[model samples]
Target: MFEQAEAIAREMKISRSAVVAIALEEFIRRRIGIVPLGEKSNGKIVVASTDN
Candidate 1:
């Protein structure tokens, strides 16, 4: 995955760390259901509900 990250970093004109950070943030917000960018965190661990 490092190779992909490197390519994306070059394409985006950003550091590899920045690309990873952005990807992690999106993963947390979507897959993990963490709070969105603007809201406050409750200092509690959040787990997405499995029940559908």
Candidate 2:
């Protein structure tokens, strides 16, 4: 997992911390049943809501 993350970070031109932050945010949102308003693409995050 760490290796994969490192590769992804390099590919995205972002730091490891930034990659971790995004993963954490996604985990938290899923745990709390917060669904994104629209499909994600190009590393963009859409609206978040609890109204799944």
Candidate 3:
């Protein structure tokens, strides 16, 4: 996973944090459709798909 992120960051010329942030943003946008970012959840860690 670290290697993959490094590859992506290198190819995109972005920081590792940016890569993670972008992934998180897309995840929240897709899964928690109605809720916005930074909202508290139900204390459950749902598995986000990595099909892209």
Number of the top lDDT candidate: 2
lDDT of each candidate versus the true structure: 0.77, 0.78, 0.75
Candidate 3 residue runs with Cα over 4 Å from true position: 34-52
- The TM-score of candidate 1 is 0.59
Q: For candidate 2, give the lDDT.
A: 0.78
- Tens-place lDDT per residue, model 3, 1-52, is 9999999999999999999998887687768673334454586445553544
For candidate 1, lDDT tens digit of each residue in 1-52? Answer: 9999999999999999999998887687778776655555696544443432
For candidate 2, lDDT tens digit of each residue in 1-52?
9999999999999999999998887788779776544657456766654542
For candidate 3, the TM-score is 0.60
Better of 1 and 3 by lDDT: 1
Record all residue pairs in model 2 with backbone atoms less than 3 Å apart, i.e. clashing: none
Q: Which lDDT value does model 2 have at 28?
A: 85
What is the number of residue pairs that collide in model 1? 0
Better of 1 and 2 by TM-score: 2
